[model samples]
Target: MNTDSKKINTSRISISELMLPSHSNFSGKIHGGYILSLMDKIAFACASKYSGRYCVTASVDTVDFLSPIEVGELVTLKACVNYVGRSSMVVGIRVISQNIQTGKIKHSNSSYFTMVAKDDDGNTVAVPRPILTTLDEVRRFYDSLRRIKAKKEHMEDTNSFDHTSREALDRLSDYGAILTL
Candidate 1:
């Protein structure tokens, strides 16, 4: 890790007691939606702290279940704000399960959640977030930013397919080249 990055705070919060119905499913594993809801809560908390405002989950790219948490076990969800962009933040969440009796802890799932901050009028708002606290974290955060930039560029390129002189003229006919919804 870079020395400067190592000095930064990478604070995280943990939530215990994620409940699941014992009779919910086969193999008695916690339902994925149940886990997702827990993740959303943790992610929101992380983002709210990072943004210092209310935040909502905008998307969940992927979630993988590596193991199962049986009923009566204590499920712990740890979440951290891993990256940020204008008006958006990405949170990393890891779910671990502990057997209530034996106290054995095992990894259960991992997910990345994207959240967006909003103002009173429901407009998206930007906020400062934590600085990277490790070389790995810095690299990952920058890589995610690159991906976001590339995605935006890709969208612009796609839209260019329909961009033409005549189309531009037609756009002006509407309102000086402004797109009206």
Candidate 2:
């Protein structure tokens, strides 16, 4: 475990790969699952580098696919440690795709991956805190804080929610889910 905190930029990583036809789906677009796999790999690399320990992805907070990537485009993924707790860190990732010929670039995806540091024994270990040096870094840190808070509240609400209740059942129609029960 790192005794001192690490700067957010210290562990930043960027990787770019050319999209190939084999990476595309039936729709002839780049596959979302393939991009997600790449994101997960980069997230793990960033978090592990920041914490100086092996890391495992605990959860993927959000993955928004904003634009479609062409098979011939170059896809780049950037990752950095956005926030850190005692044993976990949120790695923020941004993906962009660029056309080699036209030099056109499009934002393809944005996501957050929560990773937990682990010891050689496979036990959870302490991770170094993130040092925020810029306003953007501070904003990301606080945003992660809010996301964690909201997630906890949502889990609590879900646990106590009565889906079988008449009110809840009535709301099923709003989502277009048929209530056969």
Candidate 3:
């Protein structure tokens, strides 16, 4: 682990953009894909700023769109480094949309992005540790730890479980999936 550490607030970032018609879907609401792309950019920026190295997104977890954003609304995204390993960081992002006319703000989405730091040689590099100060920051760190553990356990279960077993095949009907085999 790298001994270098930085305060959590150092790398926190916030950005806002006015939603336009071009950014909307057929339903006249802002597109979820566009919001996801914005989230990715913010995650990359937050992780890179924290790590002081180029970072690549490894995965995105739990993108839940909570509200619809109107085309004329202003969308704001806030990103912060939630947790860090030797070479990886989890960035938590929250999206909110505000009706400029009514001054009403609604939470649009929340997501977690996992990013890996890389050196110029394309090798993984250790990132600076995060110095958490607030209770919310501590809670985010612990939540990230639990999420990581759950991911590992899920992968292990997937690797060891037998999908072709008779019991497993019989249970497919419970999910409304028909086995053509």
Candidate 4:
């Protein structure tokens, strides 16, 4: 067990920007890629703050665009370090857009980014453990642990799966198409 622990609140980061036309798609709504860029930026900041070292994104999970953001709205991205392992931290990001005139806000996106701490030579480095200060923070840590377990199970299943097994072929038969072989 690591003796060092850092408060979750110390790793939180938030940034808000006005959605401009240049950030939108042809349909007059903010582009998903643009939102993802902001998410990555905030995730990096949050993880770096928590780890006290340079961090790089290992994987991006659960990027769900809940609603479309209008071009003239104010978009905000909030990120926090939800979980930490020896060298990795899970950064949870929530994105919301508010209509400045009407004051109506909508949840536009939520995502999780796994970042790994790195040293000056680009080698992985260990990060301090998170000190969960509140119930909500504890719950977030549990959720991240669950997600990590599920991901490992999924990878194990995928690695051992036989895609062309009789059972798999039979399942594909539900498409109402005949198999060539």
Candidate 5:
């Protein structure tokens, strides 16, 4: 019944930067932590742009590094609002690296960041619901819904499951874990 909704396209953001030696780890590859900082920045921007309010990161639901980024490569991060739930929005981000010289591009990472709109007083505020306009938008929203459900269920199980139960101990043995407990 809420008429304050925005299309998915209006919440998209992209940023690009050259990976420098300062952003590299000891392994000579771009640091994952550095990339995560940029992701958080873009996710906040996308969520705030869509919600018309300040947004803070609630959690990073997923981050997968598929390829290592080199120091000299140009890294581009794209973020979009995939789903919205009351005060929260799931921002999907994709990271790509391009060899500026060879023009080869690599998909380095994909991640989901959950952001919550907030008021100036630091209280949670309602966000504008996302209006899915395309098939891809619909698919992304559904996928995020499923992932959030699974994460909640998994957390519940983890919180209630007995780690010292007989079956649990037996399963640990299968993993060759030496239990000192």
Candidate 6:
């Protein structure tokens, strides 16, 4: 148990104050887009390091803004490589807004991003990703896995119809059907 605890602590990566612009917004609050941009950059870095290849955002499951981040606050973005697929990786990212003066911190946003590893040709490639080395890492890994699994299942439930008007037109063309009178 002691060994496992040590591993979990090492997996936690906290990045601080990459961006907290006081002049960026009129209300002195960091824009939602700004936070997202920072998260994307950090998440991309984490995924790219794990995959050892170029990675692109496949999807951002959810990015809920719980509170506003004021200017001059230290916005800390924490991320970890949670899971990996054949050519895909998922990263868990959290943004904590900390007031520099008062030292009050609040979770401003939390999100998971799916990234696809790509080769030099921009084609998807398989790469080694992070493994759950400790209990905390395992827990986060499972959570991300569950989220992806749920998303996949939910996607499957949607209509799989691939019918397109262009294909319909091609099919009708064989009948000499220019019946647009």
* The best candidate in terms of lDDT: 3
Q: lDDT tens string, model 6, 48-120?
A: 7766678899999888889988777788888877777788877888889777778788989899889898999
Tens digit of lDDT per residue, candidate 5, span 1-181? 3668778789989999999999999999999999999999999999999999999999997688999999999999999999999999999999999999999999999999999999999999988767788999999999998999999999999999998798898789789897777
Error of 6 at 36 (Å): 0.7
lDDT by residue (tens digit), candidate 3, 68-113: 9999999999999999999999999999999999999999999999
Candidate 1: regions farther than 4 A off = 1-11, 18-23, 146-181
Model 4, residue 62: what's the lDDT?
Answer: 77
Could you tell me which 10 consecutive residues in candidate 4 have the lowest summed lDDT? 1-10
lDDT of 2 by residue, 71-137 (tens): 9999999999988999999999999999999999999999999999999999999987777789999
Can you tell me which runs of candidate 5 are displaced by over 4 Å?
1-3
Q: How do the residues 1-181 of candidate 1 rate in per-residue lDDT, one tens digit apiece?
A: 4332222144378899945675247667777777887889999988887677789888886688898678888988988777777888878789999998898999998887889989888889976745665787787677667756776798788987665567665767676556563
lDDT of 5: 0.93
Q: Once superposed on the true structure, which residue ranges of model 2 sit more than 4 Å away at CA? A: 1-3, 174-178
For residue 72, model 3's alpha carbon misses the true position, in angstroms, by 0.6
Q: How many backbone clashes does candidate 2 have?
A: 0
Quality of model 1 by C-alpha lDDT: 0.76
Q: Once model 5 is optimally superposed onto the true structure by TM-score, how far is the C-alpha of residue 62 displaced, in angstroms? A: 2.3
User: TM-scores of the models, in the given order?
Assistant: 0.71, 0.94, 0.95, 0.95, 0.95, 0.76
Clashes in model 3: which pairs?
Answer: none
As a whole number from 0 to 100, the lDDT of residue 99 in candidate 4 is: 100
Two-way TM-score contest, 2 vs 5, winner: 5
